[model samples]
Target: MRRMIVLGLGALLFVFPFYYMFIGSLQAEPDTTVTSVLPDPGNLTLGNYAEINEKVNLGTSLLNSGIFTGGVIACTVVFGVLAGYALARLRFRGRGAVFGIVLLVQVVPFQLLLIPLYVLIVRGYGLADSHLGVILPFAINTTAVFVFRQFFLQLPNELFDAAHVDGAGELRVMWSVALPLVRPALLTVVLLTFIGPWNEFLWPFLITKQADMQPLAVSLANYISNVAGRAANPYGALLAGACVLAAPVIGLFIAFQRHFVSTDIGTGVKG
Candidate 1:
């Protein structure tokens, strides 16, 4: 009973920030003090949401974010799966060297290449203020490839052998045999990839100066930095923007969270 109480308290502690943010977003007046945690019911209103929406155009920013995040997730999954399969299953002359290079790339931060990437995408490709340009640099994620490769490696070799004996090509074997057992890896990669681009502001801001093309992160950032202070209820307006930006990610995680369980890959092979 004592342990249960402790655990419940811990859970509440973790959830309080989100609860506070939601409640704060509904307030009609700015309240930054601790006493305002239990504000009067009369002060609650949806005006803050309306105000932030009017400024940011929540619908358009959300759509832009969806497109950008969706594209990155798609490209990351496809290329990551192919590259991971090659590294884990295929035997080639330079496989070790290639894998080493991938690991090396991970040690380097994306910021280091930002200048060159900007020049290549904007100057060379002439894709300024475009969704494709924003999506292109993040298309192939090395982290996702590493994750898929690790998961693929955990599978028993007998499954691949059986597929090969049955005259299945590499692609067929991967699709029918290998891919089914890596559900956890796919979900993990999607969630991980989703958070990065969804929360990313710097790169997107640099890529597109057009307000219509900007993602929610960039828009909310600009609002919080420049416009929120001028609002009637600055605290509520800022929280409202945060809630709007966070809602989809929270929803996506909730929807897919149940499928994050590990599969028993060893069951396919008879002992």
Candidate 2:
């Protein structure tokens, strides 16, 4: 009974926001107001969704997010794995220093780096307000490299040795042996990288001033601004927009939930 109650409460807490958003979205924009905490059920309508959809190019924002997220994941996987393997396996000068710097980089707050990065993108490279401008800096993730290195360090020497004996080169060994062995870590990196871009607000908001180039989070902010003094019906529509904006992330988590939830457990058990 205790477990049941806890589970029910947890489920309710998890579901409540989406439920409220849905309820808000269903009501007419005119009915959603500061005067009422809840929209009138009798006046529930999908018109808000239509209004929001008509105003914002949600499809473009979705595409931009997909591209940025995909690019970040691709860069992190390729570069992170290579750098991780080097740090884990290679014996060379400055290796420890490099790893130490990576640790230090992880400690540095992203907010601090924002100004320099923006200047570099806008003034230095002239990539201002471009998609590449926003994504390029985020491509190289220190934490991802660190995580991959830790997992790579735990790998036995015999695997590499066996591959080497079979005439496999470093690239071949990494491609065939190392990658397959660290599926959990790779998945974790991909998920984190994707999430960073998917829910990113500040960087996207700052970098992409143009409406069409903005990601969903930034677009949503502009959306709120547009509906600020509008009728209550627009509030319902705004809520609907919020739901649509959030759906992809929620769906992604739901789709890959098992992998994400079990990764830590699996790693702990294996260790």
Candidate 3:
């Protein structure tokens, strides 16, 4: 009974914000009398979404978001696995030092690099407001490296030994053996990378000033400005956009489902 109560409470807490946001988006923009976020059932309207589409290029923003997220996931998966495997299985001079440095780098916040990275993007690479500009810097994620490494370390040694006996090179082994064995970790990495790119606002806002180049988050903000400025009933449309922004993530979670919480062998260990 206590567990059921706890779970019900937890579910409510988790769901309430979205419910409120949806409700608020459905409401007529609060007039002098209707100050509350909750909308009167009769006053529900789709004006907010219409106003947003008419004013802002939301479709373009979503496309940019998709491009950015797809690139991030690709880079994170490929690079993360390679770096992780090297740290776990390979031996070379400065190996320990390199691993230490990599782990240390992970401790640094991404926000700290924003200014310097932005300067580099703007001036050094001449890639101002370009998709590659944002994608390249974030491609090398230290945390992903560490995560991959931890997972790789947990891999059984017998598999590597058998592959070596069969004259399989490291690359071949990775492609044929290691990758298949670590699907869970790969999925985790892909999901994380995807989320970071999809939901990121500040960096995209700073780098991509053009409305077309802006992501969903930035575009959504732009939508808010247009709707509120005109005194339109933005309830349904804003909620619809929010749902659009959230859909991929929510779908991803649903597809991954039990995997999100269930511990698989690939991520069974932590460094």
Best TM-score among the predictions, by candidate number: 1
- Candidate 3 has a TM-score of 0.84
Across 63-116, the per-residue lDDT of candidate 2 in tens digits comes to: 878887788788878889999988998778999999898877766776788899
lDDT of 3 at 192: 59
Better of 1 and 3 by TM-score: 1
Winning model by lDDT: 1
Error of 1 at 143 (Å): 1.3
TM-score order of candidates, top first: 1, 2, 3
TM-score of 2: 0.86
Which candidate would rank higher by TM-score, 1 or 2? 1
lDDT of 3 by residue, 1-271 (tens): 9999999999999998777766666655543253454557786766656655656666887789998888877887788789899999898788899899996875677668889988888788887678987677666777778888988899999999999999999889988988888888887777656667788777777677778788888778766766545544555566667877887888887887665544332222211
TM-score of each: 0.86, 0.86, 0.84
